[model samples]
Target: MTPLAGIKVLDLTRVLAGPYCTALLADLGADVIKLEPPRGDDYRHIGPFQQGESALFTLNNRGKKSISLNLKSPEGLALAQEIAAGCDVVVENFRPGVAEKIGLGADVLRKAKPGLIYCSVSGFGQTGPFRDLPAYDLVVQAMSGLMAATGEAGGAPLKTGESVADLVGGLFGSWAIMAALVQKARTGQGATLDVAMYDALYSMLTTSHALHFYADKTPERVGNRHPLSTPFGCFETADGQVVIAVLTPAQFARLSTLIGQPGLPDETRFATDEARTENEPELRSLIEDWSKGLNTEAAMVALAEAQLPSAPIWGIAQASDSAHARARGLVQMLPHGVLGQAPVVPQPVQFDGVKLMTYSPAPGLGADAAEILQAFCSVDAARFEDLKKAGVVA
Candidate 1:
């Protein structure tokens, strides 16, 4: 059986952060009921559609049942409350106080279902000065100093290629929910969790932030190189770019030998990690001079043979179609309704020495509404039809 087999999650979230968190729960075998708006999640309109289905939506929202509802309606709100009352967890990403204003807040639902794990994912958390401010992933990234710490030195601060701010929030939200679930199992009591994109991104600045207080040094963007580690950055070879991380003295010694610079390490400038970091420009130029003669593959293999951590920089298509990705089943062709078989990245975790089994595709915009209302809210065919007629449920 799956780890979360019997857990049921009432998901009242749209877009990235909250939906991604619930998707993780659903992947672990939680019966996630996605309570979408009547118009569907905003991600449906995002570009790069397949057979009229949003690729972004499908990638993040697999393995969940959809039930669209007009939460503005009293009847719809009441039905949502009923679902929350019976669910093991309730996840929402509405701005702070919006859930409470609509009567679906954690306080009300956790009181009704005493053991429920209620998770709120927001840009600034539920009780912060910026709680009520409207924010997207970009805003949070900039505010949390993540964007400021990216890009090349003296270059314009660049946001990450992916929506790291949103993903971080979702990851932390799932982790917090899982912890709360564990606590509930132990004490038979519920817990409320607040996951913020700003906080999540800030917490992930482990090295950069730690340096500020510990050494009175503010982090600056240094492109692909690590903040402190020497010889830990991308290098260009004859064919393409490769990354080599000589993280320890042993690795550094091995790298020097592999690059035909054995005597260089004995120099004071490149002897230790601290000295090498202080002289990274000269070190990087020296390594690149050697790499310029060898192709990327050859350089990578030589580095690997020397026991240094190194790899060629691969584009998304290359990485996705690589042998290792296929061997590990990192990507799969899943049936996403009219989209047919589409490639999706499933949950990366392994349970009991085996990969978690994947479930069904994301529901086609409330495709399970009638079934869900009938099953949970006890709205039979005629009542469900009436609610649909009244535009209460879609």
Candidate 2:
């Protein structure tokens, strides 16, 4: 059987964070019923369109059922409560108190079914002074010390090219949900998980933490270079930049030989890792002197032959379209409404005896309302039509 095959999730979430968490579950074979608002997810409007369809929504919301309901209506809210009570888990990304205000809070639903796992993904968590403040991915990245630790040394702070804060928050939220499931299986008790974007992003700074706590120093952005090691970052080449990591003495010796600096490692200033790092500028210039004479491919070939670790820098397209990606099935096609077959990145880990499981594309707005209603609420055909007519389910 597929992992999580029988597990059901009531995904009352929109946008990136919550959708991403449920998407992972959907890939793992959960029957994720995505509950959207009347208009639809905000991602459906935001673009970078794929044939006039939102790629953001397509990528993040794969393998789930979609239903639209107006929570303001009493009938719709009751329907949602019914669905939540039936599902094993309820995930939401709303700001802290909104779920409670809408009458679908963890306390309310879990009161009806104590074995329900409820997860809330937010900016700063459900409590604390910053709980009430609004949050955005960029804002969380800036405040989480990530931006301060990013960018060129002595330069302005910069957010990552991707939304690491939102993504990490979703990742932690998913992890917490699965852990809660395990706990529920053991003790027959559920959990209320609070995942904060700010805390999630902040907790990922291990290097920064090490520096601050052990070294009594604030981490300075060293651009595309390692702070503690030499030749452990992007280096210049004839065609483009390449990444080279010489972590051990053996790798350093091989790297030195490849770059025609075999005798340099014997020098006093380059004898130790710290010494080599202290004289990084000189060593970097020496390495580049040899690297700039050759193309990236040639340099990589020579480094590989010398048993040195190196890689050519690649962008999203190059990395995604790589042969390795195809072989590993990191990218696959899922059926879509407009795009026919859309590329999706499924969950990377695979369980034993599990082949490549085919998944459905993200649903059209309210596409699964009738099916989900019948399954979860056991609503009859007449009642389903009546709810639609009343603007409860659309």
Candidate 3:
């Protein structure tokens, strides 16, 4: 049996961070019930649509059921409370106080259920100086100092190519939720998890942040170079650029021999890591002078033979199609109701000999409203019809 087969999750989150967190839970075999507004989640309108449906939304929201309700209405709020009282987990990404305004806040739900695992994912957090401010992935990236540490030296600060802040927030949130679940099993108590996008991103900037904390010096962008380790950056080769990271003295010595600069490491300027770092420009140029004549594959072979860490930069397509990725079953092709076959990244954890597979398609707006209300609430067909007529459920 799947680890989380018996657990049920009430997912009230929309967009990236929160949805991604719930997606992980769903992958672990939780019975996830996505509660949407009458119009559906805002991500449905995001680009890269297929057959008038959002592929982006499908990627993060598969393997869950959807039930639409208008929380503004008293009946709708009551229905949601009933679902929360029965579910093991509730995840929401509304701005601070929004859930409280809708009468579904952690305190209220915890009082009702007593053993509910409620996780709140927001831009800043539930209680903080920036709690109420509106934030996006780019805003969090810039505020967390990640932008300042990225990109070329003296160039405009660049946000990462992907939505790292959002993705990390989701990953951390899921991890925290799982830990809380384990704790609940042992303590017979529930947990209230608060995940903030900016906080998560800032926590991940440890190396650069450490320099400022201990040395009182902020790290500047050096573009693909290690902030502390010498000879740990991209080098130009005949075919393309290859990255090499020779961090230790032994590795440096081996690298020196491999690059035909045997006595260079013993030289005063490049003898130790500190010395090499102090003379990075000259050292890098000397390495590049040798690499510029060798092709990327040949350079990689030489570096590998010398026991150095080096690899060619790969684009998304190349990485996705790589032999290692294929062997590990990192990606899977699943049936998307409207998008035909969709490629989805599987959950990172593998249990026993089984990998989690997609069990259901992304729901159409309110697709399971009637079924859910009937099964969980024991609401008869007549009552469901009445609620729909009253504009409570769509």
Candidate 4:
């Protein structure tokens, strides 16, 4: 049996962060019922669609059932509260106070079922000064100082290539849910989780934030180089780029010998890590001068011979098809009935010598609405039809 076999999650989230959190729970064998509106989740219309289905949506929302409900209607709100009371977890990413206005807030649900774990994912959390402000990944990235610290020195600040803030919020939400579940098991009570994208992104800036405390200065973008360590960044090769990190003195000495600079360890300017960092420009130039003569493969080989940690810069295609990633089953193909084969990112967990396989396709809009109503609410065919006529269940 999977770890969360008996858990039930009512997923009222859309887009990325909240869906991602519930997706993790679904992967662990929780019964995740995604609640969407009549038009379906907004992500359904997102790009990378195949055969009129959104591949990006499917990639994150696989292995779950979808049911459509219009919460604006009184009947719809009542139905949502019913599901909330029955489920072990309810996750939402709506703006602050939205759930409360809809009558499905934590206080209301907890009164109905005190053991319900309600996780609210937002841009700046529910109680912060910026709580009610609308936010997206780039906005949070900029607000949290992440964008300021990224990219090349003296270049325009850049957001990360991916929606790291949203992704990290999802990861944090999942972790918080799991921790709450553990606590519920002990105390027979539930907990409310407030996860903010800005907070999550800010929390990830561990070492970069630390520099301010240590040196009384906020960190500046230093391109690929490490702020504290020397010889710890990407170097340009003849054909491409290779990143290498030399942490300790032993590694530095080994690197010096490998690069045909045997006396580099004895040079005052390059002798110690502090000295090398103080002279980073010269250190980077010295490494690049040697790397300029070699291609990426040759540079990697030389670094490996010296027991240094180095790797070629790989694009998504190359990394996805790489031997290491393939061996670890980081990518998998799932059969999506109409889409034929859909590629999905596997959950990053292995348990009991087994990793769970993706078992369901992304649900067609409201495909399981009738079935869910029947199974969970004990609603008969007549009642379901009545609710549909009343413009509640879509």
Q: CA lDDT, every prediction? A: 0.88, 0.90, 0.89, 0.89
Model 4 CA lDDT for position 110: 88
TM-score of each: 0.97, 0.97, 0.97, 0.97
Could you report the Cα RMSD, in angstroms, for every candidate shown? Answer: 1.2, 1.3, 1.4, 1.2
Name every residue pair that clashes in candidate 1.
none
lDDT of 1 by residue, 1-394 (tens): 5888889899988899998998888878899999998789899889688778898898888998999999899999999999888788999999899999999998888778878889999999988689888989999988988888889989999999899889889999989988988998889989889998999999989887788878899898999999899999999889889999888888888888877889877999999898999999999999999998999889988887887888888789999999988888888777766877877787887777676745688788889988888888888899888998999987
Give candidate 4 regions above 4 Å deviation. Answer: none
lDDT of 4 by residue, 1-394 (tens): 5888889999999999888888888888989999999998899999977889897799889888999999999878888888877899999999999989889889999889988899999999999689988999989999998888888988888888999999999999999999999999999989988999999999989877788777787878888888788989999999989999998999998988877788898999998998998899988888888999999999999999888999999899999999988888888887887888888886887887677755787788888889888877888999999988988988
Model 4 alpha-carbon miss at residue 285, Å: 1.8
lDDT for position 225 in model 2: 86
Report the candidate with higher lDDT, 2 versus 4.
Answer: 2
Q: Can you tell me which runs of candidate 3 are displaced by over 4 Å? A: none
- What tens-digit string does per-residue lDDT give for candidate 2 at 321-381? 9998877788989888799999988778766734444379988899999999999899999
- In candidate 4, position 248 carries an lDDT of 94
Per-residue lDDT, model 1, residue 362, is 78
What is the lDDT for 112 in model 1? 81
Q: Which regions of candidate 1 deviate over 4 angstroms?
A: none
Candidate that scores best on lDDT:
2
User: Candidate 2, which segments miss by more than 4 Å at Cα?
Assistant: 353-358
Write one digit per residue (lDDT tens) for candidate 3, span 1-394. 4778888999999999998998888888888899999879899999897789897788898888999998999989999999888899999999999998889999999999878999999999998789999999999999899998888978989999999888899899889988988999998799999999989999989887788998798888988998887999999999899999988889998888887889997799999887898899999998999999999999998888888999999999999999998887888887776777877886876678677755666788898888888877878999999999999998
